[model samples]
Target: MIKVAGMLLLLDFQLLPPTASSEAAKLDSLFFFLVALCGTVATLIIIFILYFVVKYRRRTPDQLALSGRSYRTLELAWTLIPFAIFLFIFYWGAKLYFNLMTPPEDAIEINMVGRQWMWKVQHPEGQREINTLHVPLGRPVKLAIASQDVIHSFFVPAFRIHLDVVPGRYRTIWFKATETGTFHLFCSQYCGTQHSGMKGDVVVMEPEEYARWLNSGSEGSAASEGQKLFRQLSCNTCHTGDSTARAPFLGGLYGKQVNLQGGDTLLADDNYIRQSIVDPEARIVAGYKPIMPTFKGQVDEEQIMLLISFIRSLKEGREQIPPVSDPAGPQPSPVGDAIRQSETNANAGNQPRTNANSTDQE
Candidate 1:
């Protein structure tokens, strides 16, 4: 009994690393449960093996071995027991997996861009850091992760979370830190010669300290940078605030369902917004012509994130700045008026002339 107790104590020491997040605790509980179950089954199998070896050992060669007897009840018991245990494991694992994938709606959002050998973390307030993430303890954080070069994985052993960050698309993971400390962060995928060096730290601090740190380094919020990009990219020329503009007004578009040209509706989530920017022709919105140019190569991932932040901020009917016009020439009429007038002329059977000047104005 003493020996067995000592062995069990030593086994406890070999358990998983310290868990720092709520999800990590839950995951570790499931892991330990599986370990105990497997250990029990292995011990029973070993005991049975020893018993059969001794009981069947031949004492005399002439003493013909009793004809082997088969017990249907024993066979069925072994098979059914193992099968039921496997089913239980499957169901428990599936439930934990679903819980890990779903994030709370109120989670604080952060953007992460992984490159050849470094991680770029951007807070919603526009604070940027290299290879380090500062998050508040006891608050849920949702990471919108992407890779710039190749496939990378965001892994934190202490948090028991691992997610793939692929280029040209976004992946997300969330965790609520329960402890206040720094934990190891790693890119578990092999991308290049420097994959071994793709490691960082996640610093969890108190809410007040996190807020101060977020405001210290960055000059402006991400939404502000996005606003500048929106104008510089000439997006404002068509997506005007006026309802009669050629393109749909992007105000209040985030988190809302949008009708597509293919008679399908899609929720305007971050992924959908990203696809619309990089591949505009992929899913055209209903009632809108597929004339918008793609910004795939024109902007990088960080810039795209900034633009998304800006667009998401346009909630509750917030107005956007109008497109800038040249001061050296006569001002052109609003594009909305031109669209309405052209529609009226077409309805009245009049020859609707194309507004070349209006196009030049834009």
Candidate 2:
């Protein structure tokens, strides 16, 4: 009895990490309720076993034991009670999971790439970091996570969030921190030799501080970098806004339903965009020829993410390419340079040459 009392008392202390997100509180509440219910059932079972053992002890050798006994009320009560408890737990857990999976529309977006031993994090506003992530305390933050080498999980014990980052695909997880503080971030999956070292810190700050930090960085925003890549790779040549172009216009493609070749429709989300870039032939849009070359080996994971960011930034009834402050910042590709040179030479050849006689006449 003393041990049981002690165990119940220990429950007062937090068995999990500190709750730092809104969902964490809900998760903890459900967890403790289940724990208490299980504990009560266990205690009663032990007590009944002990009581029967003592009461049924044989005092005389000739004492006869009862063959069987049945209590319909007790049997029904036990069965219905546990069944009801299980149903309640399932409902509570499912509600919490649904809330966790849905993100607010105004949530801040961030990109994360998990590699063998480190995390590469990027903000849509251009700030990039290795392993560390910073966000505002009260705003919802969505992380578009992908794995470069193998499977990795993004886990924060305080937030009670764990999501798998799979290679060749993008997965998103979102959380809003309720307090301003630093929390631990870990890759829960056993990735490789340095999986233990794949750890970082998630710093939740005031809104003002987060803004200042974002402005302090000099790196171009992810969308801008992606814009540069789009031009360098000559994507605009094919996916032009002109209706006669061989490829479909990408303007306002994100979040829209696209008809595929097989008479199926797919939402043009992040994963779909990534797959379209890396695996062009996988799903060809209806009325468009499958002429796009796959970028599987040509571009890395980070480049793919930049392209995705640029694509998502597009809006309906707007130019496909947003105006960049520094349009010529990125150097032209070798092929582009060669084509320009050829054009320049051809124009020079077409110009009338001033021979000696022509110069005298002039």
Q: For each candidate, give its TM-score against the true structure.
A: 0.81, 0.81
Which candidate leads in lDDT?
1
lDDT by candidate, in order shown: 0.77, 0.76
Per-residue lDDT, model 1, residue 40, is: 92
Stretch of 10 with least lDDT, candidate 1: 348-357
Candidate 2: the clashing residue pairs are none
* Top TM-score hit: 1
RMSD per model, one decimal? 12.2, 13.5
Q: lDDT score of model 2? A: 0.76
The residue-by-residue lDDT of candidate 2 on 1-362, one tens digit each, is 99978987887845468789988888898888888888998999999999999999888999999898899999999899889878988898999888888877666778999999999998765678888998888888888899999999999998999999999888888899998899999999999999999999999988777766765643555666777888778787787667787888787677789999989999998889899998999999999999999988888888888888777655443344423434554321111111112322222221122210110120
Model 1 vs. true fold: TM: 0.81
